[model samples]
Target: MSEENKLSVLVVGGGGVGTIVAVNLEAGGHAKVTLVLRSNFSKVSRDGFSIRSVDHGNLNGWRPHEVVDQVPAIGFGKPGFDTVVCCTKNIQDSTPSIEELIRPAVTPGYTTVVLIQNGLNIELPLVAQFPQNVILSGVSFMGSHEPEPGIIEHDFEDKLVVGAFRNPGTSAALSNARARDFVGHYSAGGKTVCEYTADANRSRWEKLVYNATMNPICAILRTDTATLRLSDSIENLVRPAMEEIRAAASANGYNLDASIAQRMIDMDPMEIFFKPSMCMDALKGNLIEFENLVGEPLRAGKKHGVAMPVLTVIYDMCKMLQWQLKAAREGRSQEDMLKVYDSGKP
Candidate 1:
């Protein structure tokens, strides 16, 4: 594609998932990615990004087409993004609401918004806020992390599944066309794998079989996947929770195979000590993604009258632990976790 034909893309979220997407798009030369960053903003903008990946090899001082801290509020006479790929964690009612954060760069009828995030039912808030834009649902399976500022380590091959999230008052043609265009640019480099799915939500539910089970268990247990793999709790704990998730998905009309729960566990490479995002967040005292990841799905399943006893137990612990982390962040005692029922306490 020529320079003018290149897609104008905005990437928010600078973690493993976001960095991989930005670097690959820049490498492909099909998209001009303007990455909005935090934490590593100074280091990356000054020295560019130093990336090490199993697929693309190691890159030193690699910069996207445009690297900015903010997307710049857009209005008449101002440009907006052609595609906004939000790779941030789903933390709505958590902090830095993705809807408000990316509002400035979203053009009502022009910009195609892609959510490369986790958690079930995460599309609703963005949909409610940006009803006029074409929103695509994306799910990524990869092992990548920023071990240090401006330095990325990607050990697993990145794979993506994208499809259009149902947008009210928008034609199916427009949504599907934009999703196809995104896959083209994403796969132009031919390094990472990007696949198109007719129903993006099925993929998310399948992924949640792992995310809602293994992720939160590892967080609550304060262990890594490698450790869990070696433990006898696979049948006793993890798989039961996963079965609940699959049942929950089925209750909601997304029928997953009975084997998906076990497949997610067996697929992870044995050598790597895979620390999921929730586990890492717990270690760092950050807010665990309970609401979207566990809470919403649990509620949905219960509403459908699916008995998810194992998952329900996991959800309660996740919410309490999440509260403790937030309380600690606010300098409140962990003992105050139940005080929320008394009055306005956080």
Candidate 2:
């Protein structure tokens, strides 16, 4: 294919997942790929991005066609990106908001927005704003992280589940061509497993069963998934929270089987040992993604009148912990913050 005829893609966030996608797309040599990185732009520009992965092998100095600081820097000069992949954390209070971050790249008529984010209802805002854009909801089970500024340590798993949003006003065929072509780009290498589903909402709920249960437990307990899986937390806390999530999804017109919880629990110990994003955020003093993961689902349960007592308690603990972290960052010492945080405790 001629260079002009090939797809032009822009990947936002430049984190673990972003680096993985950018590297693979460039390796495929089938698309015009550009990456938008913030602080790591200088390091990545100088040394390129490195990926240490069990699946993809050790790769160093992986460079894309172009690197920019933000979306506006990419002057696509046409309708902007044909495909925009978002790999950032879905923090509600983020300065760019997810909407603002992708606004510059998305072309209303043709761009396909791939949301590789976690939590429930994350695509709502984008779907509402860009009704004309083809929106694909994706759930990434890939284990990867940026240990430092420009290096990604990928443990395993390349399974990315993607599906179109069945919005009432949007046509299912709106960006079908772009979505299929984008998926084809990943089909070349056997290293990555990309599954295209008809129902992305169901996929999101399925991933949520595990994320909602383990992420908060790890964060609040200051432990890792391995520890949570081996302890009473699984039976007493994890299982019950999973059930609540299942119930909430069902109430929202999505059926999540009881087996998902066990399936996630049965994941290999290697995955269990790693810290989830929420736990890492808490430890790093970054804003925890409580709203989408816990708070949003809890609110949905209330709206549907479904009882989520187990999840409610877990949600409260996560919220309290987030506030405590915030207090610590606001110049209060950990000891003073803990005293105030635990004031009503026995």
Candidate 3:
């Protein structure tokens, strides 16, 4: 395709996943990929990005063709992006919200917005606000993180399970060729494998099976995956929480298999020792990803009348931990704040 005919993709948030997508898409040499890096624009634009992928090996000076501070206004009769991938965190009550962050780039019928964030029901508000846009869901299994600004360390698996967010019991949005084509861009230069499912809700729910259990457990206990796996926490805390989430998903009309809970339990023995994002955030005195990860599931359970007692307790602990950690950041005594937990109070 000519430069004018090439598909344009704008990736918001130049973090780990955003860089991965931009680098791989640019590698394909097919689409015109641009990155919206708000903070690290000067460094990345000058020196480019660096990637240390366990699967793809070390790559230095990897840069996309275009880097801008913000989404440019789509001029009248001027072409807008064909795809907009959001890699930003969906923290609870975040400013500029996810919708406002990407609102400027959405072209309704033209742009396909792929949400590659974590948690449940993260797409509902966007779907409601931009009903004309082709919204797709993506569950990123890519084990990657940014240890420093403008650098990405991708370890272990690199795969994305993606599909259109059709209503429950509805067929996949395979008919949306744009969604299929967008998925293809991820693996354009063989960077990662992208699997398209007819039932994206199943994929999202399946991922929550692991996330709902591990994220809060680790953040609250100040532990890692290996710690949970090696001890009775797997059975006592993780497994029950996963089961409750699975039940909640089922009650919300997404029937996840009971075996998913066991699968997460079983896989813990072979996986790497690491802390989840929520745990890392808490340790670093950052805001916890409260709403989507735990709050949404709990509310869904209540709405559907499904009992999620174990997850309820975990959720409560996470809220308490969040407040205590926030106080610790503001020069409060960590020891005294921890005493709040000692009292067995919320």
- Per model, how many backbone clashes are there? 0, 0, 0
Superpose all Cα atoms of candidate 3 onto the true structure and report the RMSD in Å to 1 decimal.
4.5
lDDT of 2 by residue, 242-298 (tens): 888889999999987778889887764755586788999898887788888898888
Query: What TM-score, to 2 decimals, does candidate 1 have?
Result: 0.95
Query: Residue 328's C-alpha lDDT in candidate 1?
Result: 80
Global lDDT of each model? 0.86, 0.81, 0.79
Give RMSD to native, each candidate. Answer: 2.3, 3.7, 4.5
Clashing pairs for model 2 are: none
Winning model by lDDT? 1
Task: List ranges where model 3 is wrong by over 4 Å.
Answer: 167-175, 268-271, 325-346
- Tens digit of per-residue lDDT, candidate 1, span 1-346: 7988888899998878899999888888898888988889999989988888987998999888878887667788877778999998876475558898999999887799999988788888888998888999888887898878899999889898889999885888889988888888889899989998888889988999899988999999998788898988888999988888888889989999988977999877778777788999999887887778888878989999999899889988987898778778899764564475566755
State every prediction's TM-score relative to the real structure: 0.95, 0.90, 0.88
* lDDT for each residue of candidate 3 in 1-346, tens digit (9 for 90 to 100): 5777767988888987778777777776677888999767888888888899766677888777689988766758877888888988887766788888888888865678888888888888887777777778888887778877888898756788878875232233542565677777666777678887777777877888878888888888888888888898888888888888888888888888767877776654445678888888888787888778898888888898888899899889888887776676676776866786789875
lDDT of 1 at 70: 76
Order of candidate numbers by TM-score, starting with the best? 1, 2, 3
